[model samples]
Target: MWTKEFFGTDVYHLVSAFVIYSMLGWLVESIYMSFCNRRLTNRGFAKSPFCPIYGFGAIIGYLILHPLDGHFFKLYLLGALMATVFEFLVGNLMLKLFGEIWWDYKDKPCNYKGIICLESTIAWGFYAVIIIVFLHSKIIGFIDSWSFSMGSRVCSLILAIVTIDYIIQLSKAFGIDIRERCADKYESFKARWY
Candidate 1:
């Protein structure tokens, strides 16, 4: 399986895959929302032009489903399961940490706690097959072909941008000045520990 190569070598490719998939995810979300709302909607949770959750989900699906690739239907089922679990965990974690929900599927059919639904899982299954069987191979090859120094520079730049975007978005989601909250938390921790 081409995925075997995905496991350990070439950290640059993994980083590239993560960033590329994130941007693609953002594009898909934006296009879908635009169609639904009849206007452009930047559906990204962060100020960055990418969606990390989708990128992580894509990697997870690829890793989980690649072994079962020869058996297409079974691979899809497992991929759906992995993606659903990943979605649910990220949703609940966001709700816990930020007091906000990125998405609510309550109005959707067969939704579970507004985190996931049968329809979405089915779609994820389809996406998983395409990603694992087709996209991963090509992306890995392309990234691997790049010079190590060049790949390192590009990937590092992307990582820095995403890190800054996450910090800003997290602060915004607090709905109050983040500096105040951080100061308060720091004081509390100091009082308890020192």
Candidate 2:
């Protein structure tokens, strides 16, 4: 697969990892946000239950921090640094592209321009240790259980859904009313389900 050639992993493995991590990230963030705000919040750029930043961070940690696995302290420190950098970049990119930051750490102690903070970076270190040393093997094992063809097909379908959601969200960011344009069908579907 192209992912194998480019990322040194099969399509099923890489895409599954991305989608799974993204969903988990969304769940975590949504729960945290809902608790903080005392109301439910869907914490993601896309309307779908996926956070691409988390997926990218997980992949980067899997590839980069795997080498430091046995060195606990080193792994923690490096993971913190890596994740902080990634967070800073993504945060800034969103600000530049959308004239808004999806998350702000200004209220946090030791924050840098509200883009990154010390506490979050420290938590990221622990997260790296837990995910790499504890959770990753199980996640990989679960992914491995699925047949390649079936897993790839499912991943493809999910990617398509996420991509469409992303495009819709991007359009909204640019002041395009895609749902408004499709209001009849959208309302009908919502009325049926909700």
Candidate 3:
């Protein structure tokens, strides 16, 4: 199957988890930003009710750090470290690609180039503990309750819609040739990373 070929076993479950966490992340970020700014703000890059970065972050935490599960201290510390690094990289990449930083911490204390701050990093640790310790089982149960066919169909539909929205929003936001920008940024990223 395409799922097995592209991803390892249980691809449906993983994708379901990613989609669920993404919508939740979008909700949380939207509410938080609205409250902070005293106005409603759509925090998602696309018009869809999704936050892909959050989905990826959660998946990375589950795959890489779940081994530390039960060890709260280890999970928190490592989750914090991993998430901070992820945030820093994503924040910088967004700036380089879009010429805009999605979130800035310039006014906040202990911020590194306004890309990440101590408070947010600490919060990520707590968020990690919550997701791993509390939400993991529920998510597994939810995914398993669905038949493979149903789960795959749902996830595919959601992902397809989100991808379309992302493409439209990308063009509207930058008003430039995305291919050119991507090529230039890819070269820059390659040079920097390599």
TM of each candidate vs. truth: 0.84, 0.88, 0.85
Error of 2 at 118 (Å): 0.7
lDDT of 3 by residue, 1-194 (tens): 42653233366677889999999899999999999999999999888989999999998788887788899999999999999999999998998888878888899899999999999999999989988999977988998898888888899999999998898888878786777888999999999999
**What do the candidate models score in CA lDDT, each in turn?**
0.82, 0.88, 0.88
Candidate that scores best on TM-score: 2
User: Model 2: number of clashes?
Assistant: 0
C-alpha RMSD by candidate, in order:
5.5, 6.0, 8.5
TM-score of 1: 0.84
Query: Residue 189's C-alpha lDDT in candidate 1?
Result: 96
Superposition-based RMSD of candidate 1 using all C-alpha atoms, in angstroms? 5.5
Instruction: Specify the poorest-scoring 10-residue window by lDDT in model 1.
Output: 1-10
Count of clashing pairs, candidate 1: 0
Best by lDDT: 3
**Model 3, residue 162: displacement in angstroms?**
0.4
Which regions of candidate 1 are displaced past 4 Å? 1-6, 175-194
Please say which candidate is ahead in TM-score: 2 or 3.
2
The TM-score obtained by model 3 is 0.85
